[model samples]
Target chain A: MRLAILGIGPVCALGSGIQSLRTGLQGKVRPNIEEKIIPTSHGEKMLPVYQPVAEGLDRFIPKRALRRVDPFTQIALLSTYLAIEDAGIAFNDKSRVGVVFGSGYGPTRTTFKFLDNIIDDGDIGASPTHFANSVHNAPASQVSIFLGLTGPCSTITCFEHTLSNVLVTAWDWLNQDVVDYVLVGLGDEYCDVLGFAAVGMNAGRTKDMQPMNFNACTFLPGEGHITFLIAKDKSHQEGYAKISEIRMRRDLEEVKASISNDPVIINASGNLQQGKSFLKVQQKQLKSYSNLYGGFPTSSAFDLAVGCVSMKDRKIYPVPESQKKEVKLENSIICLEFCREDEFNIYKLE
Target chain B: MSLELDLKKLIIEELKIEDVEPEDIGDEDALFGEGLGLDSLDAVELVVILKKHYKIDLEDMEKARAAFASIKALAAYIRENSEVQ
Candidate 1:
């Protein structure tokens, strides 16, 4: 809590970098949902997936340099470059900055590719490159190498709670004086295996996500990465918002009882009958960006990234299209990410 | 395809080597460090490629290095061991 967010970077289906998010909030961009063939238990299945355009990545890492790198690593690397470039800090002593990445599923595409090789060709045919990139911390390792960060580097995975843990870890590193700034981020790429599983698992699904409709699983698999460059010191000229507090609770009654008319973003994208308690926060004029990025387990990170954009741009992006409520330009925003009725995290930004 | 040309294609595809074509690589050019600039990872990938394509097992690391010196050397090694020729 109380960490200053110097810069925020987001790469999603809409596109890469913060300007893409600004255009997305302005409703000027749409993602090209790519279809791929995946063999399921029944037969071969073609499913739609949200893939990032990654247009700005070439400016940071040339395409030839990234040919050997997996897509998952490419996504994370782009996010890091965007955050650093947005922060506008020319870091001479990179050892003072650390890296921490969270993920719902680490390198699913590369891991599956490795397994595919093992299945098609014997173990002898397995490519060593795929095996090396399949690990959980590979992205973080690659980030440290590219950024030349001698500070502590690590990765964490806990499904929906991954973002909360990542932020807390960043704050802890700053508090402990282990580093001056922390490059904290979360990402999960959508592959054919996950796409097939998502279609099979959710019977009440749709092509678009309705995050406000807590009664339905109108969800689709989305892919991308989001990063925040955080520092304990706010010496920089501008910052997104200060993380005032992070509270984990089992109920929203207190939050609703103390809630104001100010805008609050509800991370309510999930299956029906579960996470319905998030509907209790309707007392506040709400905003949700799940439609722009689609639905994923670590969507809370995406929500926070949207919150940062809203904080910086002084505008609340519309969801549900009707836009019944208008949030005052300047005010504190609270982000509520609900995993269940009893398990959720509340982030206060001011 | 000829064995030498096939090995060249395999090197480019399996190693994810970009911006280089089969014709660009000389028949007797070095495959690692000074020539194509492939390192140990590429060497390991080349091993898997050889084993998968020709069923030729270069268990001896030195012999693998010798064969990997050039696409022509790799093709000759395959011809000496593999029955396709």
Candidate 2:
């Protein structure tokens, strides 16, 4: 069974919704990176991080529902609601739908806040509300509760490849006839701790975040959420792109053998070492998307979203003007992502 | 804020009791089950609040249940057992 993307809701550093993302990809808007100071052992350090533009989520979700959820969970619910609305699908029976969400760092701020309460004022001072929302699956649970979906609900937290795993798992559920529709996506939030870690780990090499540049040592930390409503290929005619195939590889040879020299969108927003390795992939044509969304573990989700838009619009959002080249748009688009030192995911979108 | 008013505000804010104001919560109203409709999670949070703010720890399950029976009962328990001045 083939799975098709019926709707996409992307809340990223570029902007919220497809139009904002498309405009950002067209080089009409630059990424909004904010400089913030984070506390360190000796003093304070400043770092550049990509913060998502607020979309006034209160307008979509009721105040009662919003009070109990954290920022990450709020983003997930809003994105999912937007996707379902975008698909124009009505829920007659909520049990026929499922939710699968992924996150590189799940509810980091909430977890830390709970820990702070415990450490600062003992266990009795810890907020039970914060503790309830600190789990990795909190976003998924919130989505299911807010949307009243009773089908299969799960969450994956595998750092960079979380989105890939969520997509693959959702595909399996759809193929098995477990659910009629599945909302799969990723939601990660930016925290000062993450910023401090990113900067401290790559002190010398880190620079302003830019995509596809193998020579840059620094990547800007980013956080956002993107959700998609996916269903069987023949089930819906309004799909953006049909997911032809998905493959994961741990060995370089396996990735090389599976990859064809077709025009491909490369996710080159990883560390310098991974960027160097991605540079070796011989492709007839190549493009990078990290420039628009900034560098993050789940940044590939943005790339895939852009790929779907490009496919449907019959236009390719080019790389930076300095590295711009003629890209021949085709019916099929290949997305190559190197998520980790030993892990890579290849997606065939048509 | 007075102890009762403080408790009401804390309950409303911590438990995320929506569409309800601090003055709306009756002193003798049930905290769980029928009145405010708080669940077991809210009960646990109430315990934390009592201990953290009032320095009144109800270690015994029976006494804790009795104290949590109503907003008035919780306030009374805090008034009698509070270690904080």
Candidate 3:
């Protein structure tokens, strides 16, 4: 069965919604980076991170529903709601709509809070509410509860390629006829622990963060959510793109064997590791959308969203000062994501 | 604030009870089941709140269940066992 992306909702460092992202991408808006102080052996150092804009989130979800959920879950729920509204489909049978979400660091803030309570005041001081929201599946559970969706819900956390894995799972569910539509989202939240660790790991590397420069060693930490409403291709509703193929490979040779002359969108999010693998591909036509979304594990979700927009608008949003001046949109666009040394995933969008 | 009123506010805030106020909860209203719509999870949270705020540990399940029967019972139990009074 063929699957189509009915609607796209992206809440990123740039802003929320497709139009906001398009404007940011086209206008080459400067990234909103906030400085965080982290304690080190030599004293304190400042770490720059791309923080998402916090306005207009309350409009997407009810106030009562936001009380218990952490910010990670809130972004996922809001993006999912926006995608549902964008699709313009009201599910009378809520059970027919499944939710598949992906996250790199799930509820890190709540996890740290629980840890602090336990460490400071013993196990008795740990807050049950924080403990409840610290699990990896909490975001998916919140999506099901707030949306009243009784269908199959799953959360995938495989680091950089998490969203790609989620899309593959959703594709299988649609092919199996388990649900008529699937709401797939990818989200992550910035925390002190993650930011400090990132700084510690990249201490001696270049501190200047730039996603457009594939050779840059700096990977700016970022967090946000992006959700897509996908359904079978039989609907009369217009869609951004039709997903033709999804594949995950464990070996680099297999990925190279499967590559063709198709226009490819690479996931070089200013990370040295991802850039190293991205440099291996000799494809003449290449594009990267990480500058608009910043660099994170699940930032590939934003790359896919940009690809869909490129297909719909018949234009590609490239890096501001990259060597490539023009982007020719083909009938089918291939997305190549390099998660780590040996694992990669390829997506075909038409 | 009185311990009873303070307990009501704590319950309302910690449990994220929607559309309910501390003044709305009667002193003798049950805290579990049909009274406040609390469940096992809330029971655990209530135990933490008691230990954290009042320094009264209900290590015994029976004593905890009895104290959690109602807001009045909880306030009385805390007043008797806690050093706050």
Question: Which one is best on DockQ?
Answer: 1
Please give the range of 10 consecutive residues that has the lowest summed lDDT in model 3 chain A.
A203-212
Model 3 segments beyond 4 Å from truth?
A: A28-30, A54-57, A203-208, A212-214, A250-262, A320-328, B1-43, B60-85
TM-score of 2: 0.85
| Residues A144-163 of candidate 3: C-alpha lDDT, one tens digit per residue | 98778999999999887697
lDDT by candidate, in order shown = 0.79, 0.79, 0.80
Give lDDT tens digits, candidate 2, residues A216-242.
Answer: 665777888889999889854896888
* Model 1 quality (TM-score): 0.92
**Tens digit of lDDT per residue, candidate 1, span B1-85?**
7877887888888777888999999999999889999888888887777777777666799898898888788888899988654
The deviation in Å at residue A291 for candidate 3 is 2.9
Pairs clashing within candidate 3 = none
Best-first order by TM-score: 1, 2, 3
- List TM-scores for all candidates, in order: 0.92, 0.85, 0.84
- Taking every candidate in turn, the Cα RMSD to the unseen true structure, in Å, is 2.4, 3.4, 3.7
**In model 1, which regions exceed 4 Å deviation?**
A42-46, A203-205, A233-236, A273-275, A282-284, A323-327, B82-85
Please give the lDDT score at residue A298 for candidate 2. Answer: 79
Give the DockQ of candidate 3. Answer: 0.44
- Where in model 2 is the C-alpha error above 4 Å? A30-32, A54-56, A203-207, A250-261, A282-284, A320-328, B1-12, B17-40, B53-56, B60-85
Ranking by DockQ: 1, 2, 3
